[model samples]
Target chain A: MIDTIAKLNGIIQILALVLILIRAFLVVRDLTKSVTGVFFMFAIFTHLSADMYYLIHIAMNKGYYPPFSAMDLAALGTYLLFGAAAHSLFPERTGERSETIVSVCAALFAAANVFLWGYYSGAWFQDIFSGITFIYLLVTSSQAVYRTGALKRDKWYILGSIWLTFVAGQVCVPILQNAGAVLAANAVEWLNYSLMFGTFLWLAAKVILCARRTEKDQALALSFGLMCWSLCTLYMCAEPFYQLALFGETFQLLLMWFIIERRVKTA
Target chain B: MIYSENIFICIVIPLLLSLLFIRREGFRFVLGLVIGMLVCLLSAYISAFTGTVSEMGHEQVAVYISPVVEEIMKILPVLFVLFIFDPPSDRVFLFAVAVGVGFATFENCCYLLSVGSQSITYMLIRGLAVGVMHIVSILFATIGLMQMREFKAMSLPAAFGAVIVSITYHALYNLLVSEPGITSVIGYLLPGVTAVLLFLVNLRLRIRVKT
Candidate 1:
């Protein structure tokens, strides 16, 4: 069952990669492009690059994942690119003291996870790298939200909260499972699925509303990518329905691509 | 057992001396080559140590760990130069390719020394595949770095993301080529295909920029 899911997940990524390559080709062809659009495309590329490693691991290990590998760095690259996109779109500088505090806190939290879970040294290295990048994403993304004004803040909040809940479910599922609370773990997993479904429906509504708007906000479009990325990372951490997670991610990418295509056509 | 350092020393001395006659970009390329060879040697030691500590087989280590080490070592100089000298994007790209070439050349030498250069076809494939793979991977990272810098979004996540693209590409190649036969053929062709695509994309972009 797991192997089948892994293979299916790999297929989804390949399909998504093809879609991304087409989108990238289009974006690259368009001479009049924003920095945010470029970064957004690159973010997808980096994320897909990391997925290649994931696919290779599936083939090599027959669905069993190694405790740690350098490929995780590419996933980190995905977040970094998204952060770059957020920064480019918003271009607001946050307070260094606050950024530092978040960094410290993230580092401490990562360290706690490392010790609490007894992660290997290699995993610890990646965990720290992710921690630092995650904080950067949070800081830049919040800055982006702040810069987007009042009207679109609700969209950011909704998507952001859904991502947070999914990630929280990811965290709890493992802890619950480890503690022999199988029912609780199962419950958390179901909640994650429900949240994913809810987000999908919510995004569908938003896409419709966004399409109807006269001035399509770039910030909201970028936020969708960010939400998809956060979802990707959460699934990558403790993947229960790994294939489903990837399907959701690719679906989000498709929607974003559709938006870009529509905008270009209208332009 | 291969004495990589001996080969490195023998090749590097002449190159180091040639640097006196060379200037500017030529100097940077030669210097990058020399640094790349040194980095390759260091990477070998590190990989060996890691293999020993992890109790992994040679093939396992090569496929799983060495790509990460090699890619990181290859990019360190580029990163250093970027942050310190703050050179133009073209210079950085040239320097990066040079480092990759240097690293590939040294690796090929060691490989040839270990296994006799009997099979011309195999050697050709190895040279084209491995050499271009190294250059392509590093160039990918360099381009990412340049993009981030150009956009004034040069943060840790951005830089690392750029670096990790190379690492993942290297790792994927390593993973693919580790097994022989069909997979190996695909692996060998992957870099060349990617390079051609990148070249075409770059040409298109340059034309757009000019127009």
Candidate 2:
């Protein structure tokens, strides 16, 4: 039964990769207007690279690791890919020297990760790269949302990307090392996977909703709802320390959603 | 000694005063306290969970953990006010400040409870610094929201710009405080200066609103 479950998990991951690849291909073809389509393609690349890295790590433990592993290459590739996607999505505005500086800072951070840590420590390198990339995405997406005046559902896109990159890039991998029990690590892993997948689902939904009804208020509500759901879930699962994180996120989500909805309805 | 009880006094007294003195604005008052407490509890919880439940240690709290958690917590009330009342009054800036004060007051209480009369001087410095910083950051975010409301084109960038600014300010503050020597004192003083500047900006915005 355990074997079956493991196999099932593997298959699901594989299927997700395939879906991601198809999306990437479609995006490359320039056939989809959906912003999420582009994001999903990149997400898939990151997701696949991460999964492959773990698979290789596991194989090494079993004394069957392959030389010239795809995982390492994928890790490097995804890091650069994220930077490229972010640059393309939110190109520098004319006369915005500050943004350009920030973008350059992001690139330098990514490069540092690859040069300093990529060769010697796969896990550490990936974490650092992913962390920088997460911040880059947050800054980039927030810029896109701001520039486009697509405020309604854009919050979800920005928040989703931030959460996914931060959780996967910064927290999950490091925590897995000292997780003590396999169960804890596995749970955290699953949670990480769910967050990434959930982000894709959210971005896709926002795109469709926006395309269907260009109503600004509806878009805002949708974004707020998506953020709220994610925040609420995080709040429920978060254990031990109960400072201001969960409540703050939940309140922000709820407030944004409610305000947007009211504004639209009243208008 | 005075600063030891400041947290409880700051949080509870204001809450009671608002409940009694500002009965007409009861919702705002209560909302302020509730949201303030929530942010404090949540940040502490996240810091604790990542450290204990996740067993990730203090490093995680500093690097991957605190930046995202603290920024988001600080912004929640401001975001809520923006969404709900959409207060058309020029006092939106003041409203934002009120929320910030509420948040800082509660957080001060928490810190006071934990530290317990370490040094009145240190406590005052920390309280004033954190309190002012919170107000300034939220006001920045409020300005973004207000700009977005007025100019449709600026909404997205302004809103996000607000968040980034807040985050940047927060990260810098943390970095300064984390360092030893003169940086901590500078960190403590900087937010107050920033708050005064923010107040001026708010005043200017109010003038524009009137015009």
Best by lDDT: 1
Q: Write model 1 residue lDDT over A88-161, tens digit each, in one string.
A: 66575555564444335433433344333334234555566566666566566555544554225455556546
lDDT tens readout by residue for model 1, B30-142:
99999989998999999999989988889888877898899899999999999999999989998999999999999999999999999999999999999999999998888
* Reference-based lDDT, residue A52, model 2: 40
What fraction of the true Cα-Cα contacts (under 8 Å, chains A to B) does candidate 2 also have?
Answer: 0.00
Error of 2 at A258 (Å): 40
> Model 2 off-target regions past 4 Å?
A1-267, B1-21, B24-27, B53-64, B89-91, B154-158, B203-211
Question: What are the DockQ scores of the candidates, in order?
Answer: 0.55, 0.01
Local error of candidate 2 at residue B84 (angstroms)? 3.8
| Model 2 lDDT per residue over B124-161, tens place | 88778888877776665565556545533223323443
Count steric clashes of candidate 1.
1
Docking category of candidate 1: medium
